[model samples]
Target: VVDRLNLQAIVPSAQTLQEQSSRMHLKKLKTVVTYWATRQIITYNVPPLAFIIAANTNVNTGALINLYSDLQKVAIEDLFNKS
Candidate 1:
């Protein structure tokens, strides 16, 4: 196996790799918040365009968005599990 590869792989620092993971988490957050917001809009009988506009503009979905954004900021990976 050693002789098969001619190129070296670049390994990024954990912090840099964590940034990518953090972005993945933030995207998951947005999807979840959108789900909840859709439920609320259904309850309120608001137009569907309202959700589209707010999400495009990156407007706050009240407390849930704030809380999840903070969660994404502070999240860390488990030492033993890569997932």
Candidate 2:
């Protein structure tokens, strides 16, 4: 089962970017992330922590790692059941 959303669809293709140019690809990805964040699609604390973790990366590396572990707390069945 697809327990988690496919992030690749949302983020620019890493492989494609590498083929073109790593620097350009990274810039594109950063731009996309900045755009998404500025749009306020993923606001702070309004959505679940899971959603915040998925969208934002300004958090510290250790915090991010902890948040990722929280993903395991979400059952696969719950993910499938979400509308």
Candidate 3:
């Protein structure tokens, strides 16, 4: 599941700039689905926090650990049910 995480946010600026130089361009961007798990306490009043970070950039060790921890809270049945 970790391997399946969409890491598109990590595209290098240089690469993006180069791509923009080409004739092709993105007309629309959309996210059909997104899944994230976090260990932080879940609450009824507060909403879950989901953030997308660049893969090429250095991810804070603490943030990465927290993400993995949160992901564990998701039940296997629930995850599979999403499909």
Instruction: Name the candidate that leads on TM-score.
Output: 2
Q: Write the per-residue lDDT of candidate 1 for residues 15-37, one digit (tens) a residue.
A: 54346546646423342222222
Tens digit of lDDT per residue, candidate 3, span 1-83?
Answer: 76886544333343443354342333132111111232121111112432333321233444544554455455344556777
Which residues of candidate 2, in runs, are more than 4 Å off? 1-10, 14-58, 76-83
Each model's total of backbone clashes: 0, 0, 6
List the global CA lDDT of all models: 0.33, 0.37, 0.34
Give lDDT for model 1: 0.33
Which regions in candidate 1 have their CA more than 4 angstroms from the true location?
1-29, 34-61, 77-83
**Tens digit of lDDT per residue, candidate 2, span 1-83?**
34595655544444543454444354333121222331212212211432332344454444444543345456344655895
Candidate 1: worst-modelled 10 consecutive residues by lDDT = 41-50
| lDDT measured at residue 34 in model 3 versus the true structure, 0 to 100 | 16
Stretches of model 3 off by over 4 angstroms after superposition: 1-54, 76-83
